[model samples]
Target: MGRGPSIEGRKNAADAQKAKKFTKFIREITIAARVGGGDPIANPRLRLAIDKALTANMTKDTIERALKRGTGEGATEQVVEIRYEGYGPGGVAVMVDCMTDNPTRTVADVRAAFSRNGGNLGTSGSVAFQFTKTGEIIFDIRETPALEEKIMEVALEAGADDVLSEDGFIDVLTSPDSYLGVKAAFEKAGLAPIDSDVVMRPATRAALDGEAAAQMNKLIARLEELDDVQDVHHNADLPA
Candidate 1:
């Protein structure tokens, strides 16, 4: 499947966002390789991580450098991958995925963001129980006949759990075990998706509106401003 066409309305904002997002993607690759080894052939997670960077238009030079850093063949600096759990405003559960050279500084920055936003950072496993980590892949939605059928067949054949076409893309859910397989199959079929990541899936979602939603959105914005914060996942229903 191919993207139908670019949406002029959001292209500028998306371009701006991709600049920072690509940085995070690179960080993720570096850390993923560090923890799991630099060879994507031997590391499934790293393979997926690289695919994510590519999806965001990360250049090959940038990615190879990250891998070299991870493997210690190019750099000796320490880069760590850390996950933080917290409660945001309105009792919304949040999972922050981070990459940093200094965990101490990272923690302080995260704590301050939470405090200033009326949220509380919890212990290692405190808020994690509220959500499950799942593989989520999105395809750039296209206008074509037999669209859903095409996506469903590819996803299911590769062990996807479900397929939902909404928000202009087909979202394929899979157990982490099959993520790379599904991704590879789709790539071979010439369907490039927008994004894929291990996301926090809340068991139940809380609906937010009016001032509460506004506050939550603000909190998210502030959290993202922190460079250490790579990906922030929440289970609140709010409109973009």
Candidate 2:
């Protein structure tokens, strides 16, 4: 009989995963500061990025260094943001957001991930039409009872598009332009959110299961593993 995976191996894998997540968080913080300015108060995107980094237990020194790099105090290479559109297994529309200094290498890595996982790279706007960009703020239901009523009253008044409550959380949606305002309103109301971000949401979902679903998951995981890739969005509705 084959031996089970070693404990040390699992530990190493988990550590590697954590390190990758940290790298992505750092990149986001740096890019946000670079594009929007290093001051969080004046830069809503940077503020969100810093909040996420803090929530993930990133050190203050690490964040400060990234901010310095962003603001040209300790800068080296120039990192630019790019988006890749594609289709994954089972015709699932996919979008990848990346921050890279080398577009050539990033594109090649992304293309290879898609092709090897039974997917195809697409031209710009290929699958972008299938999604809508929106600002989302999520609050834990346990921390905010009567979440729906409270969120609706505050969010809608502040130009939010919708407030949805499910499971143990509430999600408030807003137009990209209204995101900062809505977030400020919630913060001023003393209803601090657990997570907030501007994201691409699928206008329609593609259902996939078994082999197709597995393949799609593999594709997404692979893309996410790339150093330059920041986020991966897809329309595939898999098992919860």
Candidate 3:
């Protein structure tokens, strides 16, 4: 018998999502290499980008090509980083980080996504004050005092700001500058984080439910669907 249609559709969607993620990683790597250098040891930003790509299962050859493109060997266009701030449904603060070769096209797409989804794009710094930029490292481990103590001991010793146990994960927060050192420390100690990133964490969350929560989710999905949108940060407290 043939596979279920729903299963096949899910597989296709997953594949598409993975491809999009790879494209974003490549762009980030190329930009990082271009701004800094191809040597990961010498360039912290590029090093982090490459690490993320590797963790995502990006192939070595693909990474090398991105590095070469960044180094201008086969690069076609210059990509620039642009941040768009806005308010989504339920007064939730939203920030969109993008790397694009064309600012005009990116901005238009971003604005349209916001407007069509019950949102309004705002000027720079408008909603930025609502967030704090920090490095977050999350470990998927059962909550235990012993493990929590171990994580705190290692992370704090490595300049981490704080450690928190949330839901089914342990979160280590760090200053942006201390992120690389802290991560290295964890790795050296044989503690591998399931996910880590420098992100704009919302200082406050806007709780929403029913229609507002649904609208907020839709807005975020729309924003993330944009090819130029690399990351979407929001302060919405919706149901999981």
| Top candidate, metric TM-score | 3
C-alpha positional error of residue 38 in candidate 3 after TM-score superposition, expressed in Å: 2.2
Which number leads on lDDT?
3
If the candidates were sorted by their lDDT against the true structure, best first, what order would they fall in?
Answer: 3, 2, 1
> lDDT by residue for model 3 over 97-196, one digit each (tens)?
9999899999999999989888899999999999998999999877454676788899989999999887768999999778989998999999888889
| lDDT per residue as tens, model 1, 88-112 | 7788888888888899999999898
TM-score of each: 0.82, 0.82, 0.90
Clashing pairs in 2: none
In order, the Cα lDDT scores of the candidates are 0.82, 0.89, 0.90
Which stretches of model 2 miss by more than 4 angstroms? 1-11, 139-147, 157-159, 166-169, 177-196
lDDT of 2 by residue, 148-224 (tens): 68777999899999988888788999987688789989989888888888889898899999999899989988998
Question: Model 3: which residue pairs collide?
Answer: none
In Å, residue 108's CA in model 3 sits off its true spot by 1.9
- TM-score of candidate 2 on Cα atoms, chains taken together: 0.82
Write the number of the candidate with greater lDDT, choosing between 1 and 3: 3
